[model samples]
Target chain A: MNPMNYVILAAILFSIGSAAVLLRRNAIVAFMGVELMLNAANLALVAFSRIHGELNGQIMAFFVMVVAAAEVVVGLAIIIAVFRARQSISLDEPAELKG
Target chain B: MQSLIWLAIALPLASAAVLLLAGRRADAWGHWVGVAASGAAFLVGFFALIEMLGKPAEERALDTTLYTFIPGSDLQVDVGLLADPLSITFVLLITFVGTLIHVYSVAYMEHDKDRRRFFAYLNLFVAAMLLLVLADSYLLLFVGWEGVGLASYLLIGFWNHKPEYATAANKAFVVNRIGDIGLIIAMGIMFTTFGALDFATVGQLAGNASTTTLTAIGLALLLAACGKSAQFPLQSWLGDAMAGPTPVSALIHAATMVTAGVYLIVRSAPIFNGAPDAQVVVAIVGAITLTLGALIGMAKDDIKKALAASTMSQIGYMMLAAGLGPIGYAFAIFHLVTHGFFKAGMFLGAGSVMHAMNDQVDMRRFGALKGAMVVTWVTFGLGWLAILGVPPFSGFWSKDKIIESAFVGEGWQPWVFGLTALIGAGLTAFYMSRLFFMTFHGKARWTDEVHPHESPALMTVPMIILAVGSAFLGLFLAVGDRFSHFLEPVTGHVEHHEPVLPVPVIMAATLILVAAGAVFAWLKYGRAEVAEEAPAGSLATITARNDFFQDSVNRAVFQRPGQHVTRTLVYADAAIVDGAVNKQARGWASIGEASRKVQNGQVRSYAATMLVGLVIVVAVIVVGGL
Candidate 1:
């Protein structure tokens, strides 16, 4: 694929992921949005590295996936705690410390 | 040699450290430690003096760089020491009198609970003042300058439990900071012009610098001197500083701190000499201080406050001498030494009176103690004589030289110095005699509750020594060229004009006038018959009782403005500034409460907001990217 095509695809995925994060009130949906954003960044990096013929980008992608999995587990645990305490998994309810 | 020089700085610091670490258990040890530290420092000063005096003119020009304190591109300042005749003289004065004051404080403060802290602060004050005098660089001198100021603040507020004392301390600190600003500006100018803060380098630069740069530096330095020396506009703080314990007043007001200004001007004599305009300003300020201090002294009823004003007046004389240039520097310093002894003695003697009268400071409450406190009376009498510049006293010799220098030197200096000195001398005699008569001559004026007695040997011993010093210290200058020769390296070649015999003769003749003033005071207030005959309704009595209208003036000018400022700040904090902040916080809390009612644990409203935010983000990305 051309570099321009790969950039367009990454940009579309990033936008969708950011929209998901903004639209979601549910903790589960927000977690999914975060995951999508991570994947979108990985896609861009891999595409760019392939165009440049570098292996470093692939290695970074692998690390990102591993870190994403860890983050999901932690995020789920925090959501579970909040749900148990407030009987709600809505992000709006958890915005207790906002200005 | 370096080690000994470092020892001079280190000894008092070590004593302060020990006193601080040991706490109250070290109180007894602290006093001894202070004595020992000052004694050792005084010894170092003596050695430095000996070394300085012994060196030939060529060898005496030795300038040793200890290290650099501030590493700026153009404003580098070295932590160095100069052992010149001038610095040696000051070091000797600080350490010698410091030791005596420390010794006196032992007995003077024996009854206080926190004696350790007192001795620690006193030792620190001496150490810092020594640093100021010995510093080779302006920046280093500033450190010492500010260090003395901090020590002054600490010593002034040593009895911090008293709000009045704390307020006085704050006033002194703030007022001195105004002067410190001038010092900072001077440093900035020196850095920009000369690229160095080392006195030697700056002096060399100043010699060849443009007149404008030299004047800027000179004026800035003069402002700094005026603050430190308690000249004119900044003179009020010293009077209020009498609220501190007496030893602090003696050390700061009389001996060490106030003299820092004169020391500064003398140290930078080259700068002032190069900038004659600035020197004129210095002379003018000094003249104002001379007249103002004497005028204020005349009306003061509190013995310490009167002496405090007298000290300011005397420092003005020294400043005037300094303003006259190199020839005046020696006379100024000579007067500084003599004035230190006499002023310290007077303050301590006043402290003795205060102590004896059970903390009563009003002169009206004191009388007929000449027999009871013979040592205090005699010592204080010597101090008065010395301060009045009476014949053969220390003040007479030094003061006469300054007046002579003024008369013989250029400009209208002789008339300024001669007139101010003569008037100041008469007022000095009048006020001091009034204080003496009020305290020792007439009938006992104390009520039944207050008993008058003599101070302890610890106090009287220092008074006796200082009294002896006051009686004879002037003769040091009279040793023909010995003093001038010793100080020649520091003072350089001062131009000596033809001896102004007529001015000295006129000044000597004015002593008769001073004597007449004393007699008048005696007839009006001192004689037993006059004391009995005078009605309480007399104008003189009312004016004297009210401190010659100065109390009202102070209340109107300083006290009212100070109170207004305080009230404004308090009001702003409580009603306007803080109120706005608090109101904002309360509004936010109320808004949150009103918003909370809409929440109702509802999921639908949240969903709607989320959808709207999602649409906004998506539409922006799609439209903007396109």
Candidate 2:
């Protein structure tokens, strides 16, 4: 029907990811939520291109997907390192930077 | 010869420096060096006096500049010396008497371990006293004034091992500082009024100043005089100043330093002549001191203390004479010269007595000493006669003139001062004869263990020279009215004014009163037995014996108030000044503690703050777009 519906779906997905990232104590769960938020932003960019009847937004969405895939690899590696060192990958466990 | 005025001061000063700086190495010959320096100064001063005398009276004043005292200033003052008839007269008196005391001290302090230091201080005092009279400017005179004060303090506390002697020294210094304040204030006023502190400028410009300024200066100078001369309220220190060596008593107290006040008054005659009210106050202070000194003198049991009281009374006469303007200036100087010889002689005679009595100062412990200390007795007797104003003695010529001048005043002023001077003279006779008779004529009061003997030749020789001077110097100076003519150049011409009573009548009255006083003294202390212990008598005697309760009055008037002020200031400084600083620091510390609560090591709170800051920035952009 309308391209606006896709944009609404992307917004709902981004809110769910933000809630998971804030509420979760595990570092791996929070990283996965961040990945989900990046994919929702890419979905919004593609839906905006369809509404405008131009291919530029779709091109930006393709580029964002490639970057998100690479970021997932680096984020998973860090979570693995924190787990090995502390025996727990929780954000609260590595709260050394807190005031 | 005029340039040689500096040598009179330098000789003694250089000797003092050497004796002090060389320490123990110079001890053996220090006393001899001190004596030789003083003797040479006397010779230099004597030649200077002759040179000044040879010059005409108008040209007698010779000024020599030493240096510019304060360079690149609006105020002009030079460190200079003025050699004139007046200053030369003082120089001759100081150097002559000072040298004799030095020689006497060679023997007087032969047994003391600190005799070298004693001679150094003595030489320092002579140099300072010479400079005091010779200084051309008030600024330079102040330097000499303070020098003598320091020397007096050192000598007074010469035996500082004793706590009381140290206390006495402090008392003399503190009391003199009061007078010094007056002098400093006077100098300040002079600088403001005339832009010069030299005597020539002030004396010439004194007529242009208002009576109020002149009177203020005169009164300030009188206060300075009273402090130095031991007059009235300041007289409390003189009796205690005798704690110094007897030679100090003779040289500084009797011969030189005490007379400085009279010199100041006579030197500042222009100011006094303009300010008659200040002049009257001076006379009144002189009269009161004369009476008070005599009263206290009559009650003292200590031989040295008695002489000190007598010294105060005699200086009072000189002060009174000085207050009478040109009419009495010459007589004041004349009396001062004569008093220097006799009073110094008497103090030395007292020292001789003490030397024989194992350093005992109590007159009650002395009796029938006339037979043993022959030279001391004879010399002391001549001084005694001179002080009593007996015929042909120095005191009669000068003191009699003072008494006659005091009577020449108009109306009630004459009666008050003349009667006071007359009574002071009578009281002087009573007390001096009492002193003489009690020590030498009363029944023996000492135990068998004590032995009285004459002081050695060193002491007796000075006493003999002073005695001879005391005996005939009055007639020698007064003959053909030569003394008056000699001093006229400095004092200006004193018109021949008749006394209120005839001259013969006044002289006769003074003689008769003096005779009556002597007779009364002989009946009380001479013929009567003196108990070794003093009696606790009535109020008058008790007050007189306690130095008129002067210490008590000063304590109540100055000391208690000063303590309260100091205590209040300390409290204010602690509570107000310190509290303000502490409060400011505490406020900042509390603020820091409050700010630290936000930095509680929590990442969630920091993220929340960042979110809130972003929301505020978005809201501001939205509102501006609307």
Candidate 3:
């Protein structure tokens, strides 16, 4: 019944996803962490929508899933191109973008 | 409607326009066009003189308003031409002498490649000088004033291929601009005090203004006069200005343009009449310059430079007279007209000598030229006699009047000015005779390579006409106080006053001093075997040779200090003004350098930074809700 508990769960999941993205060197693993963060946000939204007696959060979660699917196709294609070019898909391998 | 007065200025102006715009295409006939334009302007001005003479003195002034010059809510000025006795006198002098000079230049500048440009500038000078005399308002007069200044600069630097000549031109322009500042400030005061810039309105309302305002205007006009007339402090340029063409030295520097200052003073009779302090200052400046010029003239070995010094001294006499009030205004103009003749003739004579001697200017290099150039000698002799104030000659009539008028004031004023004038007369005689004897009367000093011959009739004819004016113009004009009566409507009639000394006694003393001076010069440069090289002499002689070291004094007094101030300002600009901007720029750059660390190409670092920012925002929200 407590919507605050949902926010707390979302916070914990976001922390874990951020740790995976920051700690992992593989580009695919970091991308998977981004998907985890989005799912955690969706979970929090649904919990809030139920507490407020609305279906808006569920509709937004479906929209986010569709957007995430499109993002994965483009991001994965970019990572594969990077692998072809430099023989690596690690995030740290693209140091050409360094300041 | 003497609207035809504008034609006097327009013809030459049109010629100048055509020659300047046509460029090289006008070269073939440009000089002839220039001569014709000047001649036509003379005719217009000559007829205008006749028309003016037909009217009574009061009705002689014909004001022709062409259009509005500057339209304003509070200050409206008209571009008008005034044909009056005073202006007509100047017009006849300018146009007549101007035409003669133009004709002389046809031969004088016969071979120069830039002869067309030379003629264009000469025509431009004639038109501007005519406008300066004919303009009905101060604003309009200033336009002509600046026009002549430009014409003068162009002509003086006509041979700008030479660096020194260009520098001389710049010197003249810069000095004249300094004088022009006084005119501008005077006009500003006129606009503020009288609510108008036109001559008539200001003249009528000048009495209503305070003496302080009038004095300010008077001093300003004097400064302008000093610059234009080459009097005192502004005189260094006159000697250098001989770098211009011979006709230019004759026309603008000697005759017309330089006298614009005297004209300005005489024209603004009302303002000067109210400011006695300003008048005294003017007279003092005149006296000092008169003596200084004579001294400088005595030492110059260059014929043109010597004559330029003489012109300065002669103008000083006019200025001294001008500063004496209405009593001396007519005499100032009288001397101006006659000096316009003799000095311009002598300059042309110098030109003839130069032309004959293969452009050699040193008097030591010339001698016994009188035999080769008879017509030049006779005409030059006439001008010498006329300037010496010899009896029945022009200067005796005109210059003596100025000398007499300079002695008309009260107290020690007459003594100082009278003594200065007398001393100046003696100095003039010595120097001018020295020049004449050194050139025509002494043993031949020229080298075999240079053959002295008479110039063509084109040059001699003008010298002849000017010589005639030098000899008879004064005698005819001064026959019955006729010149004074003609100028009375503008200058106002002043009853004759006895000078401090009896006129006859003063005249006798002046003649005696002149004789003594001529005898002295004869003994030094004529009777003795003159040295081919100038021997280093006394400090006094060296001082005169160096123009009294005026340039050095000016550098020390104004230029060096000005440079220092400018340099200090540049340093301050770099340190204080720019320092603030540079400091801010460096501060921002350092901040940017620090911020660059955050943009490191590390996806893991960026994600960690974003996670920390998200946590901070969520914690703030949670604490606020609790």
Q: DockQ numbers for every candidate?
A: 0.05, 0.21, 0.73
Distance from true location, Cα of B391 in model 3, Å = 2.1
Ranking by TM-score: 3, 2, 1
> Compared with the true structure, what per-residue lDDT tens digits does model 1 show for residues B1-626?
42367578889989998999988788667789888998999998787666755667656644567777667765566778877778878888888888889989998899999888998888899889989988888888998999999999898888989999999899889889989999999989888788888888887878888888888998899889888888867766788888889999998888878999999998998788899888878877887788677767766668888888888888998998888888888888888999999999988899899899888787777888888899999999998888877878888888877777766654566676667766767777787788788877887877689767888888999999999999988876667856666667777776657645576486766677679778877876688442332356567546644545555776898779999999999998899998999999999999998887755544445545766787799899999995
Using lDDT as the measure, the top candidate is 3
Docking class of 3: medium
Report lDDT (Cα) of residue B52, candidate 3: 80
- Stretches of candidate 2 off by over 4 Å are A1-99, B585-626
Candidate 2 - CAPRI tier? Answer: incorrect
> Once superposed on the true structure, which residue ranges of model 3 sit more than 4 Å away at CA?
A1-9
Q: List the residue pairs that clash in candidate 1.
A: none
**Comparing 1 and 3 on DockQ, the stronger one:** 3
Error of 2 at B609 (Å): 10
Model 2: how far residue B95 lies from native, Å: 1.0
- Evaluate residue A72 in candidate 1 and report its C-alpha lDDT on the 0 to 100 scale: 88
Candidate 3, residues B144-176, lDDT tens digits: the string is 999999999999999999999999999999999
Q: Which candidate should be chosen as best, given TM-score against the real structure?
A: 3
Candidate 1 wrongly placed segments (more than 4 Å): A1-99, B1-3, B499-504, B528-626
- Using DockQ, give the best candidate's number: 3
Look at candidate 2 and tell me the lDDT of residue B373.
88
> What proportion of true contacts does candidate 2 retain?
0.24
